[model samples]
Each structure stands twice: as structure tokens, then as C-alpha cells.
Target: MQLVVGRIGRPHGLRGDVSVEVRTDEPEKRFVAGAAVATDPASAGPLLIESLRWHSGTLLVRFEGVNDRNRAEELRGTMLVIDSADIPPSEDPDEFHDHQLIGLAVLTPDGERVGEVSDVLHQGQDLLVVRRGKTDVYVPFVKALVPIVDLDKGILVVDGPAGLLDPDAIV
Candidate 1:
């Protein structure tokens, strides 16, 4: 259960420093020195954080053994991950990770099976993209439209209007 935390950017200065686009909400608390994080597309080994700090709302990190501009440049665009077991528990029941909803089934309020959630898009608004046979539908994740999300049953009950799945319907 590895979760992505950040993405490494290009070298910032000559002191083996690289910018990171923090994806986690608590970046400062998560990217502490000596903490271990996995980097991708190399997923076999984990990178140890030697130092970390905030810079312009982004994270600046220096990893052990990567002490030069060239070394840091090579890690650009790599994603940082941590074991999901290390993630602190959340009190909010609705705050589910994107990975948890990837394969859940979607149904209408009337108990009609709609489709399976193929992907969760996080743009300006969160969207649950469903795939039904050959048809793909995008459903907004607003409470008014999605009233029930039964994770235990592996299904989400939506309350959208008629023709919401039609190609011409407003997304």
C-alpha cells in the first residue's frame, strides 16, 4: 500500500538540492530528515531523506548520496512514495484515498447498475469516471449527485438526472 507523496523537480542550486511538488497535504510533517521514501519509476529501492525544507510553497529535499546538481537532475520527475501503513489515520469517513475507489461499482439511486469507476479525476472538481461496456460516463462527485458511497458493498449510489449518461448531457 504505497502512496505517492511528491514529485521530484529539476535541481534548484549547486548544493545537491532538488525541488519537489508535494502531493501530500502535510508535506512538512511527512518529509522529515532520515525518513524513507520510495522514488519512481524506480520502485525497487527507497530513497532516504537527508534534509528537507519548504521553498516557495514547494519542498526542497536533499537525498543521501545524491550530493550534486547532476545527481539531483537525474531524479527529476520521479514520484515519491511511502508505505500506506505509515499514513496516519483519518477521522473523516468520506475522506478516502483515490486508490480505494478505483475499482468500485457505480449504481443509480433506483438500484440500477450503471458501471464501474474506471478512474477518479481530480481537476478543478473531483469526477468519478465510469466505464459501462463500451460507453464512458463522467459523474461529478458532488454530494447532491452522489449521495451514497457504500465502500463495504463496493458500490456508489448516484442521484443524477435522467440522460446524465448520454453523450450530449452536461458533465
Candidate 2:
């Protein structure tokens, strides 16, 4: 399985160093030097971690053969992937991997199908982007709002506030 671990940000300096928006919790294990990570577009590369270090709270990485800022800039916005048979389990029972939620059905408390989980947006809190007909709804993934996330059933039970799904008006 290819799991998304991080995204390459803009070049940090002139030495081909780039900042990473670490998506996985296990950065220490995933971002180790010499590790190979697949890129998003398929053509970019399996970006090898030639060097890895942390500055304050953020992680900085420099890939092998990418020796200048221009080379690093080319990789900006590219998602880093790691292929593993074992995706690390979430320590918190309530937490879930983005992939687990991505294609699940979204239903209201009354069991009406609202949409499908199209994407998982990670701001301060993760938001479930559901595609409902012609529109997209952003539902905050909180216990109060999304009470149930049943991976087996492939459904997310939401108790969204009025206008949460329909911004212009209540559904």
C-alpha cells in the first residue's frame, strides 16, 4: 500500500533544501536518510531522503541529486508516498488515516445519503470534503459533528448544523 507521508514545500534555501509538511505521525521512522518516497505525479521521482533534519518544529529534507534551489522548487506541492504492507495504526481510537475516510459514504443522522468522502483536508483540525451532487461540503471531523466513522460499513454518520452542507441555504 502506498501511504501519503508528506508534501514537499518551497525551497527553504539555496542548497536544494526543502521544507516538508509532514503528514504522517511517524516522521522519525518515515523521514530517515536514504529512505525512498514515491512522488504524486508519477513522473517526479521516488524522492530519496538524502538528508533529514528538524528546524524548531518543522522537518527539512534534501533529496539526492537535487543540488540547487531550482531543483527543489520543481518538487513543491508534490506529495511523498511510502509503500508498506503495514500502515502504522492510529494510537488514538478516534483518529483515522485519511485514506480510510476518503471514499466512505456520508450520511445524516436520519440515514440519508449526503455524499461521498472526496478528500480529507488537514487544517488545524481535519475536515471531510464530501461531494454532494454538483456541490462540495466541508464537514468538520469532530466527535460532536461526525459521531460515527464506520470503516467496515464504509460510512460516516454526520450531525451537521444547518447550512453546513449547503452554504447558501439549509438542506
Candidate 3:
């Protein structure tokens, strides 16, 4: 299993530094200097991380053999990935990998089946994409909304507000 850790954004400066949109929670562990991460396009890398720094809260990365802005720009939109086997299991019970959450049954507080977790989106806010028949409900993955995650039972309970899970409900 390959897990995406980040995406290469536009070139940061004249050097080979490129802005990275981090996808993983542990950026320091995954985006270390001298680490080699595989790329989605396959041709772009195995990119060796020469160095990394935080610039105004954005993660900036420089790859080995990439010495100029033009070279860095070439890596734009490239998905940085690593083998899932490299990731250790989290000690926190509340923490979950996207793979673990996906395919789990989604239910309401009263035990009504809502859907199945099709995907986990990690934008500004984490969202679980629950597939309910023809509709895909975007449930905010918060303690208030998703209070239960019974991995042993392969089910998660969503305590969303009335219209939050109902796609057909008129706003």
C-alpha cells in the first residue's frame, strides 16, 4: 500500500525549493532531509529530499539534483508517497489511517445505517465521504459528529446535525 504524504506545489524560490501541501499528520517524520520519496508519475522521482524548512507556515522542500527553479517547477503537482508498511500503528485509539476508516459501515446514533465510508478527505477540515445509495454525504470527522469508531466491529457512528447527512433534505 502506497500512501500519499504530500503534493508538490509551485517552485518556492530561485533555488530548487518547492512548496509542499502536506497530507500526513507527521510531516517531520515523513519529510525528513535525505529521505527518498516515490512520486506518483513514476518518472518524476524517487526524489531525494536534500532539505526541508518551514517558510511562513508552509513546508518548503528541496530535492537532490534539482538545483534551479525550472527543475523544481517540473515537479509541480507530483504526489509524494511512501510505502504504508513504513508507517507504524498509532498508539492513540482516536487516531485512524485513511485506509482503516475507508470501507467501514457508517451508522446513525439510533443505529440506522447511513452508508459506508468510501473515502477520507483531508482538506482544512477532515471529512468522511459516506456513500449512501446515489448520494455521497460529506460528514465532518469531528468528535461531536462522529463520536464512535468501533474498528473491531468495522462501524462508525455519525451524530451529524439534521441536514448534514441528508442530501435530499431541502435547505
> Which numbered prediction scores highest in lDDT against the true structure?
3
Give the per-residue Cα lDDT of candidate 3 at 70: 96
Per-candidate alpha-carbon RMSD to the true structure = 2.9, 2.9, 2.2
Task: Write candidate 1's Cα lDDT for 1-33 as tens digits.
Answer: 677778899898998899998776567777899
Model 1 misplaced stretches (Cα beyond 4 Å): 26-29, 42-44, 121-125, 131-138, 162-164
Between candidates 1 and 2, the TM-score winner: 2
lDDT of 1: 0.81
Reference-based TM-score of each model:
0.77, 0.80, 0.85
Alpha carbon deviation, residue 66, candidate 2 (Å): 2.4
The best candidate by TM-score is 3
Query: Candidate 2 lDDT, tens digit per residue, 45-122?
Result: 987889988998889999999999999999999998876556766798898988888899999899999899998887
Candidate 3 C-alpha lDDT tens digits along 34-138: 889999988999999999999999999999999999999999999999888877888999999887898999998999988999989988899999999998989
lDDT of each: 0.81, 0.87, 0.91
Specify the poorest-scoring 10-residue window by lDDT in model 2. Answer: 162-171
Instruction: Judging by lDDT, tell me the better candidate of 1 and 3.
Output: 3
Residue 69 lDDT in candidate 3? 97
Q: Give the candidates in order of TM-score, highest first.
A: 3, 2, 1
- Once fitted onto the true fold, the runs of candidate 3 whose alpha carbons sit more than 4 angstroms away are 122-125
TM-score (C-alpha) between model 3 and the true structure: 0.85
